[model samples]
Target: MDEQTATEAMDNFTAIWNTYTLEGEVVHWLACSLYAACRKGSTPTVGKGLMEGNCVSLTRILRSSKLSLIQFFSKMRKWADMSNLSQDFRLRMDRLERNFEVSTVIFRKFEPIFMDMFQNPQGAEPPRQPRSRKHRRLPCHISDVFKFCWTLFVYTKGLPPLYRADGHVSSDEPPPCVLERLCELHDGLVVEAKGIKQHYFKPYIQKLFQKQILKGHEELLTEMLDPQNFIDNNKAINREYEEYVLTVGDFDERVFLGADADEEIGTPRKIIQEMTTSQTAAQSQLQQHVEKSGSLAPSTPLTGRVYLKEKDLLVTPVSSATQSVGRLQSMVAGLRTAPSDHLMQIFKSCSRDPTESILARVKTLGQTFKEHYTNDSDDTPGAHIEILYYKILENVIVQETKRLHGRDMSVLLEQDIFHCSLMACCLEVVLFSY
Candidate 1:
């Protein structure tokens, strides 16, 4: 691709690719954008084939861009940790501190302090209030991530097994695997939040970056807003991280606006304020409330998405020439592997009709590979999934399989993966479940 074309492709795909980079390596993904851009509108040719004018081999570039196994996994193992995960944890934790800052301002402080400076209401009764300083919110530092996760770990029902897996909790330090799982939970939280964010929050980009609602001082806001404010000559990305400015104690002053602008304690909505009297008459009948118990629905199984790893994954031995490439890939990358007894039995149970067998397996798999939690206050099961978790043994797998074809806004990942991975699932579910 030409340099200009490549730059445009990078810009267009950056945000979408950013989500992937959160979970994978950053280096090779540019190759993805480049590969897509070259084929965008022009081109009838596809695959590892050469681009017409540039004569560049797209496959070669993509293959070469992958990360080296030496960087993480051993020649024998399936997976390893990367520095990017920890780096992202710190970065996202810092960003969250700033994002929530705008919500921390007190209602009383809004009128006199923030509203006076920005809105400048006429005939206000504050007598030109004296300046005061107080903490608005707590600093959410990288240390806080570990601290909160440690709290969760302390009471987690599953933690004992995890702790014992690494020895005991009464050592010089807590279990390292627990720490790893803690970070995994954080990552999963960010993933789910960002999905909802892209749907619900990003449209109001102003609340994220606007200055008038939050800016107390023009110069400071301008300085913080500038991407180049704190850049180092050697850094690949901007050092400013301007999102951090939101946590510097700026709040949305608009809370004091609307019908309640003049109210002393602030306006109340029609809830109880509109009631004719504080004490209600029998004429105003009090109605009993009723609630419904919806049947529990576990998440659908994720299938299909067996893309080539952008980095090294499982390394199969040389002697296993009879082993399927699917089996080798199952270790870390592909959803293909040798069938487990559970899976073989699924198909064997109904050899006359594979469809019935597949659907049954889907239900069981869906019910099994799920997360669970517990609380101390109730006699209810410690495993949140509970009897429902094993409901698969009876109706789970079949129920999930019936849902295999449907439209859902939320299980987009599961839907996409299910279709893509359906053919090879018998080989993959063993590891997928484990």
Candidate 2:
């Protein structure tokens, strides 16, 4: 408004215009125009800032020149680097600079638009995080299905007959009774994973390939092998998967080993016959006693009969007792006929929910404590304690950033197997003391 200041501003603009070429002037004019919009409180529409010789058309003219692109970015960075701008503005500017250097096309297309937004933000507010890439592998579908079956077998302390083919199951179905029982005791050792094929190991990986973020399949299989990614992920997914394999996976193995006590080449027919006889005898005894009398004899003289009948008859009738015996026998028979295989344990651990009941709660708690330091909350005492109960996975990315880092891009890639392995280890350490 003052004569001298107006003259000085005009002189400065003229000097800048004369010194730079038509292309360079574009960046300068665009920067100035954007800065003015902020100062004058103008709404930022993409069309508002474009002028006859502004940065927009300047970029179009030099579409074929890499030098022009570089120079334009340089000017953009200089403008963003201005000290008078707010810290949040500075970050957007910095990101713009990085975008240009790393993602040239994206930088060119969006930088100006973003710059306008910063100039006239919808309201005076703090900036939010920009979208970034996620690099953890997820459990595959088959792996998830297997883990669920293993969990069912372990929970029941044996493979149900419906899940078995013959008197003996193979290594792929339910393990031997000893193994199944063991799995129940250490079902905490059984871990699970899901979304591996889609979350981490998706069917298509063209984006990762284009970004040069992945390598060989073997390397992808072991992406969580690094320690740094482990720590960061420790607070996130790495801890979860590590807990699964360690707690859930281990339990499955224990059950398999325990269920199959006799590792001899073959089970003799005599032994099978003896086992069957014993089972039948137990069933017969329980049934006979339960069915002895539909209801206590009207004049039965047992000392406690009168009192027992009065208290128990309401909920459990004599006929119910006989039925219960039969149900128990059926359960036993089903257990006896269940499979004895362990091959699908890996797959099973990848799918099912790890924190379903009381046992799963304990399993998860143990896993969480293993990775991160226990939560410190007196009021919400067992808040994080839930984390310790069931086996929850924590995924992490451990990159080899130093000597052998770059040679293996696989470390940078994602994979479910590696994620679960790390999570299993963490859970095991946390749950089982040392």
Candidate 3:
């Protein structure tokens, strides 16, 4: 390096010596770091004020994208969920931005659908939707749309990258979320759930309140989680979080998907022990892998950073089938045993193999469709949703025929069916709840 350049660099380093510590190009941003503390109630580590600093407005940063709320936040939500932020925040995300324009537009389109999903409108047609977006109330509560998105975001940790203001998805897919099944369980439980105490949720919550789970709060929980008193969780916010050297705790999954605790509620002890052993084995393997490479490569300087953007989304349609089956099984959990297995068989039968002749495929599935249309009652799981699916599929088929250029999903189906197996795939996926 030039002597002049070296002298200038040394002078600059000397000026900011209090702000950062450097030892042979290593930087410790002691007080001048830009990384702001987010998640609202996070406590400081390394004495107080370590992470306390001036903040940049993430909302302002996002506004530069000029995208709708769903589009802008959808990808970020997915990344955050993948990072297990839900486990940290416990579904308390920042409030929705004041984009009533986009939220109201989607709500308006789905108002009639939500209203009549439960009850069949007694007329030749459903109620006419209001033309004005400014109306405070409509046929269905506008908050229902927000509620749907909120529930979906909390459970699944994401929403679809919706492009349209009228609540249409970019793909010819069914509704992005299968919320009916979840709602069914909640509604059923709510009838019996007079209050938090009535559900006996505290016992299950108590098991998770271990120091290994919440960390450092072992003593605090003794007093905090006493029975006959409301657990003041707000006071729990001041506790700092700690991480191990190499791996995320295997209990991370427990925190993310509390299904294990839910399942063990009334389960046999032998089964729970066996499941616990299996989980321990799996986690040991994961811990070994994590130790080898760690969370980042060359973990010396800790310079690795990540930014969430629209590019990270995977656009496959398999998620539809997965959620549908989950929703169907959940909705029917009280009514039937082995609903998931039965639903899977039905879905497999409805969607034929890709290599099969279109005529043979359609003819066999067409027969199945006729049976469904004739036999299924409107009160059944996904009965109304099935109609909505087929109706959308019909519209998709029409649009494909008239479009100048179309994309190919399957070669054989595209040759014979013109629009390809999107229609067939849609049926298979939508049939999850059906």
Candidate 4:
């Protein structure tokens, strides 16, 4: 063949290979292409014998058998002979021959039928015709449904930080709103296509959860939920605060005093006395000027320096109850609503006793608070709200435990039931956030 014909033949072969590769039968289809090219005498310079040798080499590389190639070639020869007498083939060939690019046109025309034959190489019986039935069942299996759910869960859980901004699986899990809609779709499909109950596959799903596909992820889940982790995180913040204070406190004190202690060549007492004398002398000078001016002129309030006495800077200690109440009030301010007002009232009433009735009331109010605030927006409540809700619940549980066990057994409040309730509440909040 000339250069143009050879290039066109290669392009046609490539297209055929690509289409067959999608169906996972590239080697067989390639052998058929070689057979067709040779039979049509398309590659004139590259004779049939050399083409057969190339096919043998390719089949070996592709791990196909010579016998299969030979059989495929025989089938192609038979098809070509029949094409001469077949009116449909004759008509298509005549129409394609009208094109100047006859080689590509012929290849494209026959490639589909050749692919069909290759797909059913054994010449199996044709598929059964569709029956006219009122209902048709979906081909989905129980395993397939479970696999999809598990795959979705794993994909979301394992997403890199770029994809998961919040980065906690519980918080990052697919939203319940979205999942509910998906389940609705699933139910519709089940009923319409399979003629089954909406929840016919519920048992399988339950079993999957019971099996815990995330079985080995206990450590990660615990790390995410552990209260001690939060406590340690707070402690880290406090440590950083202390370090900052120590580093900057002396410098601030020196700047406020208007003289660096190291620059003054004197004992500590002498330096203090000198600073005091200068301040008194300056005040006296100002008084004399004011008296001379005959009227008290407004002053600029000493520009920048902040004067501090040792007594004025003392830290006052606050009781834990006052602190807790103040924190709770601040948290409640985030939700400016009637439900929040009701919650604050309930919190105040439960402060003294926190009885079972009071605890139940708080629980009911919490659910109401979430419903009222979360129903209208995609955004969850701020972290402060979630933390405060759990903290109050923890305190109430502790108080009830202490009331039942007596003051001597107050330490027992942190054990058993208290821990479990706190964990459960944390998990619920995490899931609710998602």
Candidate 5:
């Protein structure tokens, strides 16, 4: 292979191989190919015969080709043993590589921010003024080694656990491991809010309410119950987070879009607004009321507001949205770790195929694997084949979630379309159970 080809192959190989446990057969093939290439003092001509070499021979060949065979082998060994390398070492290796490894990709992501900082040194966010480090890059410091190490740590540690003994994920799991961290964050927020309430309101309220003129805590009540205060405090954070999610979704679309696709597509915000309006309109029609004469009144419609206020409720809108997200995240977490007994029940309740069932799918998947992939089969239950189908199911869940912008547009609908789309593929008619 030429320099370009070699670099490309290594990039593709390291991108996955660095993170995953490669099968023995795959490792042998890679080893043999590297060995043969080393023997020839150039890129090895990979073929069936060259891919079945001994591990020792393969290691020698890799050393001959890359000159960093020791480190590479160490990484491979850790992967085989299902262990992790030092975060610092991993970051160093990733950056030293002349290809797009995870560290390099992260650095590239921060490029725009770096350029902005360089242009206007006095900006509001001047690249966070990297913490003073001992070993900075030459000539005013190109990069921070510690920062890179931390970034690598975050990417690997924060990344969702992709491998299980079964080598599979479930239908209802979140895409990134970030979701779990987000859950932790949600809990932290709740704790903080509770602290704020206890510290600021509890003591002050007792004294304020004790005043006879106030009459039964009404003086302190207005300070707490006013909807305007909730909006005023949380509006900025809510707007910023909403904008960030929209931007991320847009980025995902841009990455996935075909080259021929138009660049001027409608923004997610516009699409979501339109959908929300339509859903609100539909809900209004359902809640429409008639006067005592039994004739429908033109002005009487169901609660058409995005948020309905209860007479005695006490929660900020942002707090409610946060709780909703936490619930959704928990639902995902439950689906991941639950056993077959509970798993089957969850799927049965959600799927359109109440009879065929996830249990049925599990069994059918086994048969299909035995029939077509018998030689490749392992002793594990619903191994690789079943996992592949489960991944597809998970992807469908993501699509449906995105379609509704993480809100149940059909929450107003009597039937559970969101549930059906995420879990039920076979049901022809989903009855609204509002």
Candidate 6:
């Protein structure tokens, strides 16, 4: 193989070896030897051949090692299978690759902000004194390392020749044990780093919430729950809805146009104009009524309203339109006042017994995982379970922080929660894998 192909082959081999082998040093040496053999066009024996090779060749090159070559190659073969990689890793890699270009640009644009956040966890100001060596050594600021490893893991996973274009595992691909091993090692390292981060960053995270960096607790909470922001968000959502309506309108128009190709195009234009005029007249009447009553009348029509049904297009009735408007207004009003009430309830609950509420939430999530995913053979339950656990834990932490500090502490809570959950998950995986 040429240099590029040899390098690629080595990468693939490392990923497989890492995925399967627990002993890093032994696997590393074995993989290097195998890669070198492959580079020189001497293929490594795999599967049955590896297992049964001793009977055929007593002088086999790898037989001198303390570890059986047969067992090593057999394990390598199993791990080399593209399907052996975890579903979560595969999906993450796929997503990363799909957005690789966009993510690169976005990361570059926000690089300074990211660096600042990492270097100065306090956000607003630097610490007066330098942190202790132990604190400085924490992996809390190594999010980028995890990200890079995840990407590499995905890339290496794909490098296995067994991966088919249609996503089926091919039996004929050459096993590259070294690359697989390396990828697995990277995965373990990243997981361990995250655990370190979670352990060390908890106190700093709490301090940040206590400090209330950018704004006071109430101000931050109010800003987060502001109805005005909700309204602005709705405006963007409404634009998407309008676009959808226009698309559907065009589709309907095409259907009608197709049925009567001989009909003048101007006919549809005239019909649209008439509809617009009627809508405008109704709006004018509704405005006059609202002006007289100093509020919307019960029967006032909303302007430019159209509803698409399964088989037909319908104009909204004045009373129905008015009711819709009232419902929306009520919802918006409820949104404006709901946050404070919810926060107060959470505060009360936290004051009574914060741990109880947290435990209850965790229990609920566990039950949900069992009920929803335990019997679903198509889904991998571990990733989903981890996600649910993380979300619940984060919410609990956020609520607890807000209750104690009397403000939204989500800005700092988020980073801390992520690291903590990740560490917990890594520990869980280690326990289960053994």
**Scored by CA lDDT, what does every candidate get?**
0.33, 0.34, 0.35, 0.37, 0.36, 0.38
**For model 3, how does the per-residue alpha-carbon lDDT over 1-434 read when each residue is reduced to its tens digit?**
23443354344435445443232211211111111123222334555553321222332223333322333334434434433345443332233323323333333443344443443222224245578867532233233232332222222211122311333223443333334543464343433432322223323233335423322244233333232121123123211111210011111111111223223122211211123567989888778867998753445665454543565676556876666667755543444211134333322343353333533544455557657656555454334333333344445544543441333323323355542354455456556544
Error of 2 at 427 (Å): 78
Clashes of 5: 5
- Candidates in order, TM-scores: namely 0.18, 0.17, 0.17, 0.16, 0.17, 0.14
Which has the greatest TM-score? Answer: 1
lDDT by residue (1-434, candidate 5, tens digit) is 34553454455456546666354334443543332222233322347233211222332333344323333434444443343435643453344332223433444333444333333222233133447866332221223322222232232222222311132222453223232343353333545544434444333334334432122335334432133333332333234333332322111111112232222111121111123567988766756644333544345455354465666777887777667545534434323321244334434444253424444545654565457534434432224334433444556545555543453322222233433343333111111110
Estimate the overall C-alpha local distance difference test score of candidate 6. 0.38
> What C-alpha lDDT, on a 0 to 100 scale, does residue 138 get in candidate 3?
27
lDDT agreement of model 3 with the native: 0.35
Off by over 4 Å in 2: 1-67, 80-83, 104-197, 200-434
Off by over 4 Å in 3: 1-48, 51-54, 70-76, 94-434
lDDT tens readout by residue for model 6, 242-311: 3332322111111111223223111221111113568889999989988888766355475323553345
Instruction: Give the alpha carbon lDDT tens digit for every residue of 91-177 in model 2.
Output: 654554453344333223332333332332212333333456865443223222223223322332221234222232123432222
By lDDT: ranked, best first:
6, 4, 5, 3, 2, 1
Worst ten in a row by lDDT for model 2? 264-273
Whole-model alpha-carbon lDDT for candidate 2: 0.34
lDDT of 2 at 316: 52
Which tens-of-lDDT digit does each residue in 1-434 have in candidate 4? Answer: 24443454466567654543222244444544443443233221334232211112222221332323224434434434533334643443344233313323333333233333233222233344358666443333322222233233322322233432222223343222233344353333423422221222222223223444322224223231133343342333334333332322111111111233222212232221113568989888889978887645435675333553454544444454445546555655554322344344443444343334434644565566667556533244433344555455546645654544323333433244663455456545444433
